[model samples]
Target: MKLLKIAFKSAANRKTGLILASVSIALSIMLLLVVDTIRKQGKSSFVNTISQTDLVVGARSGPLNLLMYSVFRIGNATNNVSWKSYQEIAAFPETDWTVPLSLGDSHKGFRVLGTNQDYFKYYRFAGGKNLAFAKGKQFDDLYDAVLGSEVAKKLSYKLGDKITLAHGLTSTKFAEHGDKPFRVSGILERTGTPVDQTVHVSLQAIEAIHVDWLSGSPSPIKISAEKAREMKLNPKTITAFMLGLKNRTATFRMQRKINQYRAEPLLAILPGSTLAILWNTLGNFEKILVAIAFLVLLSGLLGMLTTLLSTLNERRREMAILRTVGAHAWHIIALFLLEAFMVVLGGCILGLIASYVVQLVAQPLLVQLYGIHIDIMFPDAEQWAIIGGALLLGLFFSLLPGLIAYRRSLQDGLVLKV
Candidate 1:
């Protein structure tokens, strides 16, 4: 009990130094925890964005490019698959269902996807939940459009609102599809994927909108909207398609068939395999981020050590008095370790609180602007291990000053003075 009281008084006298040490440790914990969380959640978000789809078929190109255009809506497709190919693949015995995607043009910076209603039924995300309509139904007419949750909110659009497509994927007006405006018929629930950032319309509507355009430019011969309705507007090609397999075992067989199809040199890739490849190519960048975080942690620890070592001289008189009162060298060592342990524990708690606060403030912006989902919660198993390691490190470093005190006590005992 006397030893405990003495230790408490010692720490209280050095309250300012302790606070600085705690702050440094807290910052280190914050860097380590948040960096790990971002890495894990980023991978989770990427993997969970698409589910249950066996294959993504697109033109011959880099698998990452295909994924970017088909799944992420980030880039334009180099070439499209013919309608005949789509039909042929859909008719394969191993295939269960297929959703075709025709991408070109944008409405207010959101990519417009032209597909059938099976997209809502066949598509799954983050736990196999099918796409749900937040308001109204799917597109029922050629002029009706379905807005993504983000598109509707960002543009302040509601059912029956009219929006025109741009000639390109941007909102800039160098070339615009102003003549063909579509009415918003529905809004989709937030899925935290590219779906949340897209505008969906029927396949016929895509052809209808591009009828007067040739080679992505406005045609010299213009036709009225009423005349376009009378003309045939069926899409003959599409950017890509998502296939669901009837039997999971036949996935490889179907992929081989598609790749070797005589109609065209099509590429069929398993989403999981492509995703792994994508991560492997990009994994080094994540490692660099983690390394930088570790560097920051090391710097923080050095600061704590410097602060402690520098302040030890000023506390030498206090330590000598405690020794005079019969506190052993080992007791002094335990006191320093306890102080470091307390600071580290408190810093970890504060760091966790700060991480949650940051996530809360950044969640909506990340989803809205970048479509990244961050879950702010208790640390995972890996994070707990990191915290444990940090605590052990704190104790290890704390011993440096404790050892100095033990040596000083031994010398002072022989001289019987400070």
Candidate 2:
């Protein structure tokens, strides 16, 4: 207890030097924990982006490409499946419900998704959670649109606001559907999925806007939005579709039939398998993060070591004073060791507090900007292991200075009259 008191006083007396080392260690620990938390939570959110769907069907293409464009709003479809094919597939006995997706349009930079009532009713995310509107109702009219939470917030859109879409997936002035603006009838609650970054419109609305489009360009004679709505607006094709199975046992069988469909070359992928592939592809990145974290931790420990070693020379007089007061060399060693342990303990506590505070502050921004929902909770076993390792590392690095203090005390003892 006396040695602990001495150590505490010594650390307090050299607070400036010790504080810098503590801060470094704390920041490093915080970074490591934050990276680990984000990686695990973000991957979980991505995998759960779409769930309860048995199969994702798209025109002949690589499975990853199909998954990317259909589910993630990335890339473009190689070809569109005919509406006839969609009808036939959806009519299969094994299918429960199907949500067709029509792509190839954009509002600002957000993808415009042309789907139907089934999309809202059948599409599930984050473990079978259904879509809920934040305000107003789903699109009931051909020209009505539903905005995702992010879209509404980022672009300052509200119910009854008018918005137009470009013909392609990006902004192009020449292919603007300026004459056929849609009214925002609904705003969906944030789902932390790709759904939040999309603009939802009905399939008929997609057909209506393209009535005067020919080969990706506006026709010489364009139909007004009013007239286009009055005309037959059935979509002839769609980019992709998702199907929920009537029986879980028949999932693979239905997948096989869809893959062998004679109507056209199509690919069917199980959402779970596709997500697994995505995670496998991203495994290396996670390893990279772990490596970077360890490097930072090493740097922090080295900083603490440098601080202790540098301060040892100045502490020689203090050590000699202790020897004259009947302190043993082992006492000097124990004091330095105790001080290092306390510094590490203090840093660990600060790191934990800072991590929670940062996550709390950044949670909303993460959901809004990147559609990642992080769950802040007590550290898991792995996290505890990491913390333990850090403490051990700090202790190990600190022993060198403790040994140096021990040697200095012995050398100064002979000169002391006492």
TM-score for each predicted model, relative to the true structure: 0.88, 0.88
CA shift of 91, model 1, Å: 3.3
Predicted structure with the largest lDDT when compared to the true one: 2
Tens-place lDDT digits, model 2, residues 331-408:
877787788888788778888888898889877677655556788979989888888998888888888898888777
Candidate 1, 1-418: lDDT as tens digits:
6666766777777778777777776777777787788778867878888899999999878788898889888777889999998998899888899999999878877788999999989999885889999999999888889998989998899999998878777666656767778899999998888799889999988888778888877898887777788989877999999999999999889889888988898999888888788877767888887787677666666666776688676766667777888878888888778777776777777777777777778776767565667777788999898778878888888899888977776555433443
- Score candidate 1 by TM-score against the native: 0.88
User: How much lDDT does candidate 1 score?
Assistant: 0.82
Over 4 Å off in model 2, which ranges? 1-20, 328-330, 342-370, 375-385, 414-418
Q: What lDDT does the true structure give each of the candidates?
A: 0.82, 0.87
